[model samples]
Structures are given as structure tokens and as C-alpha cells.
Target chain A: MTMYVVGHKIPDSDSICGAIALAYLKNQIDEPAIASRLGELSPETAFILDKFGFEAPEFKESYAGENVYIVDHSELTQAPDDIAQATIVGIVDHHKLGDLTTSTPLECWIRPVGCSNTIIKMMYDFHNVEIPKDIAGIMMCAILSDTVIFKSPTCTTADIKCVEALAEIAGIEDYKALGMEMFKVKSAVEGTPVRDLVMRDFKDFNMNGNKVGIGQLEVIDLAVFDDIKAELAADIAAMKNEGERHTMMLLLTDIMKEGSEVLVISEDDTLIERAYGKAPTDGKVWLDGVLSRKKQVVPPLQDAFA
Target chain B: MTMYVVGHKIPDSDSICGAIALAYLKNQIDEPAIASRLGELSPETAFILDKFGFEAPEFKESYAGENVYIVDHSELTQAPDDIAQATIVGIVDHHKLGDLTTSTPLECWIRPVGCSNTIIKMMYDFHNVEIPKDIAGIMMCAILSDTVIFKSPTCTTADIKCVEALAEIAGIEDYKALGMEMFKVKSAVEGTPVRDLVMRDFKDFNMNGNKVGIGQLEVIDLAVFDDIKAELAADIAAMKNEGERHTMMLLLTDIMKEGSEVLVISEDDTLIERAYGKAPTDGKVWLDGVLSRKKQVVPPLQDAFA
Candidate 1:
């Protein structure tokens, strides 16, 4: 049986890299598996794929199979449109679960870790499957990017431990230096079109029966968004017009400050204040210590809507 | 930390006994666990508990704890009402998953087996924990009850194997005779009130946003339901009046004939014909070779609603 192993839409380094590692391990363990991505990879993810000897996974909109293994996501909204029709035989994810149900009982391996690749490394060790250098390099890049070089609040001891083991396996001496090299790509949005810049790290969600879209642009310099704020706002409005978005936002995250200047757009302006308990100044709100959207943004927004 | 291990709300033999067996196994592995039940036990389950010299578990309305280990069933409708508030630490179940989500990832062990007790028995063997004779007796009763003495279509070789091994452990020389003794309890529905008879082995479900209920009464005599068909239909209508039920059915399953005479009551009689491909003759229809509600009933009914 051919099982399509894929991650959630809006592929980050962790989602794309974790899909490849799980597909590799599943094949090595005698299951016919192919790695796939649900959406286009971000620039940092593309850079990591080139740094390692791995090609970007083939993109597909939806999957229909007797057996499909979902990797790195458990949300029904984030998965492919036809995911509810497929028999989801297995899931390997690191995020909180959402409205996903299966008619048949299946294997679900979800861990509360910083990065999905950290859990994949543990799975490889559990199955006694050796991690090759190229795969290990991508796995390390995933951990580095998702955990923000061990500086993100999401980073855990498991992520750090896996990085140590995988760094040795990939023959990388200085992980800190390598992490800095990846972060440099996150700042390469200087002349990029406003639409592509905002869409790079975008994620769509269904909350309170409303489609909510949020994008993050991590940069060392926060002044870039200030220069292009009008263009960014216009792009957000255009994206919202595509249909069914109750609210759309672009998080101009100052990486070094460990915070985000969340630009807001919605039918009601007070929802931003209601969600975070703070009013926005000029259609933007400062969210301190908000690094990850899965942990930080969605929960309070859901509460506000509730 | 004490965790209350429980099954679904209308506790059957498998749900009750599997909770006991899982609680025992978890305690054997140094996890502090207590056997519990969500609702009242059925007569067959009560008989099994009395025969095995085990006290019925304490009943509770909702669990709000640091950790709770769920066993037997999956699905928010089947679980305790406040299950969403609890931090689910581990889940060992057999049925299809429903709209249940955990904020943090934990150990979820689900399999598509005839009985949840079979999964618990395998877990016992996996952990090298010897099964006690009384626990094995309850586990055997659970498997025998859920699998209809290895006759249900849901039964697999693994369930049969567990039954054989557990039979040896529980000192059961004739499993078929024991199963006959249990089915005798189901046949004793003479003095029971119509509402109680209809509600005895009932389970409520949400099929495509419509509330549906299916109850079963396994008996040697089909003439019992033929005597009071109108009373059963009236009780079903009264249950529907309680709100949120699109359809209600009671399966008059003849154990010897190995088929069910389904008595249905609904707002729309055409949906029943569309679901099972036969119009009910005065609110009663025949379903040949249908033994398991989970495997046989829910899937097609869900499809019809969709």
C-alpha cells in the first residue's frame, strides 16, 4: 500500500523536514511511503533543503488513499481538504489536537515537544533505524528553525538533546553558527513583493466557525515592515477577500526582542483588544513574548470568539 | 497523582471490566490508577462483577484532575461531560475516535479490535505483568460479551487468541456455556418497564450534527418484542421529546437466529429506509447478519446522513 506522508499546509522547516524523516523511517521499516508537502516551503526551509542534499517535496492539494500517514499536524482544518475522506492510519505531530476524528482506530504518535523533528529523532532511536547524514542535517535544521536556535520559548530539552546527537551525525561542529546562517535567510525579505512576503509563513485556521489567517515575518530589523506597512495592509485585505476570513493578521515579529507587532484587520477592531486584553495603536498591537502562533495566538483568539 | 480510569457513559461488560483490567495493569506498572465507571452498569456487567468477586467501581459525574487515563471508548459523547476540562494523560481504547482533543500530547493507545479488553490483555503481555485470576475472569467476560462469544463480525484472531489465553487463566473450561449463562440475563426482559427496557443498553450518538440513538437487547426469544412493539415505539418517541434526537432505534437481536429485528422511530421514516435499504413494517425492520452496532450500524447511518 502506498502511503502519502505529509505535513500541514504552510510548510515550515519542521513540517517539511519531519515529513521526509518519517517517510524515510516508514520505508526503512518495510512500509511503502512517499514524502509530500501540503504547501510551498518558506525561504528558510528552502535554504535548509539546499544546504542539505535534499530536494523540496512535491506539493499536492489533497490526498485520497486507503492508508495515509499525517505527519506534524493534527488539526483537521490545517490538513488537506479531503483528509476526512481518507483513512488516516497514523499521525506524527507535536502540536495540540483539533477537530480530527477517524472512523477506524489507527496509530497516533503525538508528542508535546518543541519541534516535530525532535520527536522523529526519538522515533528513529526507538525503532533502531539509523539516521543518514543528509536526513540528519535536515532534521537538525528543522529543530534549529522551529526552536529558533534554542532561544524560542517553545524549545525543550528534547530539542536540545536531539540537536546535539544530530549535529554529531551530520558532522556539524558549531550548531550555533549554523543556526545563525539559517536565520539570515529569514531576513531576506527586503525587496520581495508584499504578497509573497506576507504569504511566506502564513497559516489558516478555523476558529468559532470563522476562518482565521495569520502570517509571521521574523526579522532582525523591525523597521522594514514600517517602510512597507501600507503595501502589507493592502495585501492582507486582498487575501481576506479570497473568502471566509473573519480576521487576518501579519505578525511583524522582532526576533531578538522575542515579541511581535501584530498588524490587525477584521470586521471589528475591538476583537483584537478583546483577544489580548490590550487596545491596538494605529491598527497594531504589541504582543510581548509571543513567538509561536500555535501556542500564543489561537488559544486567546478562540476564547475571545467564545 | 491518582487517575480515575473509566470507560464510556452507559458502561457495558467490556467498558466496565476493561476499566478494571487497565487500572490493575497501570498500578502494576507503578502508575497510581483507580478503576471507575461513568454511569450505571448493565445487568450482564453486574453479573460478571458479582461472579468475579469484584466490587462495582465508584460512579462519578465528571473528572477534573491533573491526569486521567481513559479506557475502552473514544469520543466526547461517550466520555464524561467534563472530560474536556481534564488533562488526559493516557487513553487505551478500541472504537473509532470522535471530537475529543487534548491540549497536551500524551500516550494514546487505540486499536480496531472487537473488545477493549483484548488491547488491555496485549498490554499486560507487553509489560510482562502477570494477570491475576480475578482480573482475568473479568477480562474474559468483557471479551466474551463484546465479541458475542467470538461470533461478532468485529472479532479478530487477536481477540479469539486473547479469549483462549484468558479462558485458561480464569479457569473457564467451557466459554460457550459461560456465554450462554450471560445471554440468559439479556433474555429476562418480561417485568421490565418499556422505557427501562428501551433504555437498558442504549447509546446516543451525533451523526452529521443530528443526534441519533441505537439500543440493543440480545435475547433468545424475538416474540417478547413482538408482544409490545407499540410500547417500545412510544418510549422512543418520549426519548426523542427529550430533544436532539433525529432518530431512535432498538435492536431486538435474537442470539440464536443471529440477526436483529430493528424497531425504529424517527421524525423521518424515509431516512431509515435510505440507511438500511428497507422500509420498516410498522416501525420494525429485519437486518440479517448484523451483530455489531459500531461496525455495522454507525458507518452506514453516517453515510446516509452525509
Candidate 2:
């Protein structure tokens, strides 16, 4: 029987690496497995894959009607995949779970570990599977990306152990350095459309019965903050016009400062006030020492919504 | 010095429990600690906390200018609280990290375990702290919610072990059953606004240079699907009218059927056709044996996007 390993929409490093690692692990157990990308790899992910000399996996837009093993996302978006033909034998991921429908025998592994790659690392460790250096590097990168280099709240001990082991295999020290380099290369704020920047690494939050969208960009220099502020402001306004029911907050954060100057465009001034006191001059609010959105911003905004 | 423990926006069970657990742990070390909720607890979380007889923490709108230990969510939204006053000694979380701005004596523990509660559980085990039955129950419930009762792609052995131990302390023999009950209660899709349903529990993804939003609602019975379908169709059309640049797909998954009937609402019909073989007669595509958005639907749609 063949097992197809796949990741969620808008494939990130964790999604991509998780698919590859699981496929490799399944192949070791004599299961015909192929790693598949559910969406086009981001440039950041593409760079990581290229560094490892691996081609991006064939993209599968939706497992909606096809049989496949899932990872990294929830089960809310299931499609018409024939599970009888190809049973979803296993799953490895890091995101919150949605309801899943599986008819055949299923051995699911869903950990809140920062990345699905961490689970694959555990699988490899448990089975003693030899990880290729390139794969190891990819796994390490995935861990770094998903966990923000062990800075995110979602990270776990397993994530740390996986990174440590993969670092040795990949011959890399100081993932933070590598992460900074990656962010620096990608943080070139010039020429990129504000819409694209707004959508980049963006997520939706339900705020006060409204669907508020937030996007975050990390840059080494705070000067980039000014570069994108106007465009972000216009784009956020446009996003609200474009059907986002609530507010759109764009953050251009300085990694070094561990703080951000927020650009918030919202129809509701109350939300702005509730979230960041009064909107600051220059369309920026000083978030004293806040850095991670998941850590600092979301909780309070969620409270306002509640 | 007192340390305030809080979580990111839309604080889930993990965020709340993690705050409590971290506070409890810090108190063991004689640190002045207080657990605060950034948002109102979801029904599922409320159920867990009520079951355990623990009062919900006070809600805070933002962590701006406060000394805080962030959990569940990242720090990208707001700045880290000014730890200068009350040394923000450590961080324990389970989400991706964003930029952090603290250089004090900080002990950051970011692991990718299934739940932040697991990290607290580890600390409990390490310190030999008695697992209070109420705390144990809440932690276990948080695990179940975050991991989707071990059905999410993110579950790990540590999560399992933690849940097992906590279940014993909580006097619950069948967590699976309890989880199912919780899910059943949470997934009930009656009288909820389609927009709110869609936005709640939604995360953003960066698609191939396009901005796309996907939302999922878990329904126990197919009867409610028609109402949800109608409401969502209008909402999607409104979203498109408001100028949402990309597509919006909503999934109404029936847990019993182990499949989802997808509602494809987009300006581009071809994108839907690319993911699902053909547009349904009612714009609703029936995906058989396909459940799990991350595994089945998103990958294929991502492929179409690519």
C-alpha cells in the first residue's frame, strides 16, 4: 500500500519538512510514500529547500477529493479524497485540530510541538532511521521557522531536542544567527507590494464579533518600519474595504528592539484604543517590549473581542 | 518583584491553563506571580475550568507596559511588557516566537509539545508538585482541546503521558469520551453567525502571492449545513464585494460522515475546479471520506494555487 504524506495550505517550512520526513520514515517501513506540498512554497521555504538541494514537492491544492495523510493543519477543510483506496494511516502536525473524517484504520499523531518536523524527528529517533544531512538541515530550518528559533510560545522540549540533534547533523551552530540571516535576506521591504506584505505571514482573529486580520513583518533595522508604514496603512484600509469585517493591524517589528511600531487601520477606534491605548502619532503605537504577536498582542485583543 | 503570566489573543484553554500553571510554578519558587487571561475563555475552555472549579483569571486588553510571561500566542502583536520593574524571568509557551525584547536574566522555555500545559506538567513532575485534581482536570482538558483529543496532527508522546497522568488525578477514566463530549458541545453549529463562526479559530496563511482566507465549522448533523451554507454564501459574496483579492472557502464537516461538503465561494471558479474536480451544482462540493482540512483539502487547494 502506498502512503502519501502531505501538508496544509500555504505550505511553510514545517509543512514541507514534515511531509518529507514522514515520507522518508514511511518508506523505511516499506510503505510507498511520497512527500507532497499542499501549496506553493513561500520564497523563504523555497530558499531553504534550495539550500538542501531539494526540489519543491509537487503541489496538491486540496485533499478535498483525493486520499492522503494530513499534517500541520486542522480537519475543517477536508475534501473528497477516497480514504478506502488509500487509508490515512498516520498524521503528524503542530497546529490546532479541526474535525477529521477517517474511515479506515488511522494512527494519528498531532502534537502542539512548534513544528511537524519535531514529530518526524521523534519518529526517526524512535525508529533509528538515518536522516540525510540535507533533510536534517531542512528539519532544523523548519523547527526554527515554526518556533521562531525557540522563541514562540508553541515550542516544546522535543522541538529543542530535534533542533539540537539536527544542528549537529547539519553542522550548524546558533540557529538564531541563521534565523537572523534568513530574516535579513527576506526583510528587504522595498518593491514588495503592500498587499503582499500585509498577507505575508498573516492570520485571522475574531475580534468583537468581527474578523480582524493581522500581518507581521520582522526586520533588522527599524528604518524599514517607516518605509512600509504608509503603504501598510493604505493596504490595511484597502483590506477593510476588501471585506475584512473588523480591523487590520500591520506590525513592522525590529527584532533587536524586541518591540514594534504598529500600524493599525480600523473602522473602530474603540478597538484601537482597547488594544494599544490611543493610536500613536505617525500611525505607530509603541509596544514597550512586545515582540511576538501570539505572545503579546493576540491575548489582549482577544480579550477585547470577548 | 511580581511576575504576571498571560497569553496571546483569543486565549484558548492552553493559554489560560498555561498561565495558571506557570503562576503556580513560579509561586513554588517564591516568586510573586499572578495568572491573567488576555481574553474571555471560549465555551470549551469555560467548560474545562468550570469542571475543575477554578475561577477564570482577570481579563486584560493588552500586555503593553506590563511585566509578563507570554504563553500559547507569540509576541509579534505587542511589545514585551517592561520587565525592568518586575523581572520577567522566564517564558513558557507552545506557539511560534516572534521578536522578543528582554535582556535581563531571562530563562525562556519554548517547547513544541502538544500543549503548554504539558510543559507545566513536566515542571510539576520535575519539582514533584502534587497534581491538584482541579488543576489536573483543567490541564487535561486543555490538552484535549488543543490536540483535538489526539486527533490533531500535533499530538506527541509527552502530550499523551501528561494527559494520562492528569486523567488519573482528575478521576476521569475515559478522556476520549470526555473529549468527544466537549467537542460535541463545542461543535454544535446552531444560531452562530456565519462570519463569527468563520473567523473564530481561524488562522491566516500566505498563499502563492494571493490573500486567501479559509474557515471551518464542525457540525454534528447535516441538517444545519443548509443554513450555514446559505449564510456563508452571502458572507463570501459580501467579502468579495468588499474587495478581498483572493478566494474564500468554507467547510461544513460532519464528524459522523467522516467527510466534508465544501462550499466554494470565490471570484475564480477555476480555482475551485482545480481543487475539487468540478464545481458543485449548488457550489457545494461533496468530499467523501475526506476529513481533515490540513491533510485532505488544503494540500490540494494549495496545489491548485501553486
What does each candidate score in C-alpha RMSD? Answer: 4.3, 14.7
Candidate 2 local lDDT, B59-116, one digit each (tens):
7665444567766643433323342333344556554333343322244454556677
lDDT of 1 at B231: 87
Could you give the CAPRI-style class of model 1? acceptable
**TM-score of the first chain alone, every candidate:** 0.95, 0.81
lDDT by residue (A1-306, candidate 2, tens digit) is 565688765566777877887788888877788888756666677788887788888775544444476766534333224333344555565543333433322444545467778877866765678998888998999888766667665677878988999989988878678876676765686777777777766666555457777778776777875666776788888887787457878877776676777888767667766865666665568786666675567757766666
lDDT of 1 by residue, A1-306 (tens): 888888888788888998899999999999888888888888899899999978988787777654778877778877888987787878777776667787766766666678888878967975789999999999999998888788777788988999999999999999889898888889888888898888888887777678989999888778767789888988888888885688999998877888889988897788888988888887788899888776778778876876
lDDT of 1 by residue, B260-300 (tens): 88888888878877888888988889999888888887778
Worst 10 residues of 2 chain B by lDDT: B96-105
True contacts kept of 2: 0.00
- Best of the candidates, TM-score: 1
The candidate maximizing DockQ is 1
Cα lDDT for residue A249, candidate 2: 83
